[model samples]
Target: MKISQISVFLENKNGRLAEVTRILAENNISLKAASIADTSDFGILRIICDQTEKARQLMHDHLFTTRVNDVIAVRLDDRPGSLAAIMTLFEQNRVNVEYLYTTHIGQEQRSAVVFKVEDVERGLSILRQNGMETVKGF
Candidate 1:
């Protein structure tokens, strides 16, 4: 229903992002998807990787502040009004998105959009009842 996304709390300074990537690279963890939200002082690095638990432990061992959050990943047609259709469902169900980020996969014909909703279970159930497909796996 949902996937574990690695959220890293990092200072908003030069080389900080690179350091995190280096750590993951050294451990051979492949990043499948990622997003970042930042402020003046800090940033949250939301990442989806093949080895989530291992990535979490590695970050912890390296003294980096991180957490694992359940985020919903969905597949959507890569065309106009695709997203609008999904949001319409949430609006109908009164589900607050809170925050969301997306990435594209495949070519222009088909693609996927991953989102982080406020409530995982409720969101999943709503999506299911509405016949929305959820992306799975690490």
Candidate 2:
């Protein structure tokens, strides 16, 4: 399964991140998972929210440059080697992971990993054939 993730490009300055969070909160967009890759000048803020299209519109209205990407999330055991095993699977399948981030599924003690891979559908299929559970929603 693939999830819609919005990425906002922002300046790497103090309060820039806070400002985005505040805007989303003020607009009632709840973040399910998020990640930020920063450089000296700017940063790419990737966000998975309940209302994806609404969030994108809000970001655009705020004058922030943004884009939507399709990512895959997999639920796995929260323990050592769990991540390694997944990577191994990807390697065997010749799938390249451009980037990844994790979120916890509380109570169940499972870890939900969001992956940006070259082939989203292939990644999902590989995880599925290996008995991995793919996250369908936030």
Candidate 3:
């Protein structure tokens, strides 16, 4: 139901994103999914990595502004109506999605949507009742 997400604060200037990626690459942290939310002068890089704690520690050691948060990652069918169905479930339950990203897995067309929901447990239960699976990384 709950997963960890790393939010790295970066300036809106050039090379800022490159710096973050370089650091992660140097540390061998695999980014499974990522999204950037920008404001006027800065942006929050929300990232799901293979090794979250280590990535956080590495960022801290490098003096990168960052925060760790709990989120939800749901696997959905890749067909056209799949997303609609999932969103309908959440809509019916009034689950607010703060952010979301998706990626394909293996050979299957089905995709996994990583999201930050308003209510973790309730969202999980709603998804459970609808037969949706949550991906939890160790």
Best by TM-score: 2
- Tens-place lDDT per residue, model 3, 31-61, is 8788899999999999988899999999999
Shift of residue 66 alpha carbon in model 1, Å: 0.7
Runs of candidate 2 with Cα error greater than 4 angstroms are: 106-109
What residue pairs clash in candidate 3, if any at all?
Answer: none
Q: In candidate 2, residue 98 scores what lDDT?
A: 98
Residue 64 in model 3: lDDT: 92
Model 2, 93: alpha-carbon shift in Å?
Answer: 0.8
What value of lDDT does candidate 1 attain over all alpha carbons? 0.85
User: What TM-score, over all chains together, does every model reach?
Assistant: 0.92, 0.94, 0.90
Which portions of model 3 show Cα errors greater than 4 Å? 106-109
Query: Which is better, 2 or 3, measured by TM-score?
Result: 2
Worst 10 residues of 2 by lDDT: 103-112
How many Å off is the CA of 48 in candidate 2?
Answer: 0.4
lDDT of each: 0.85, 0.91, 0.84
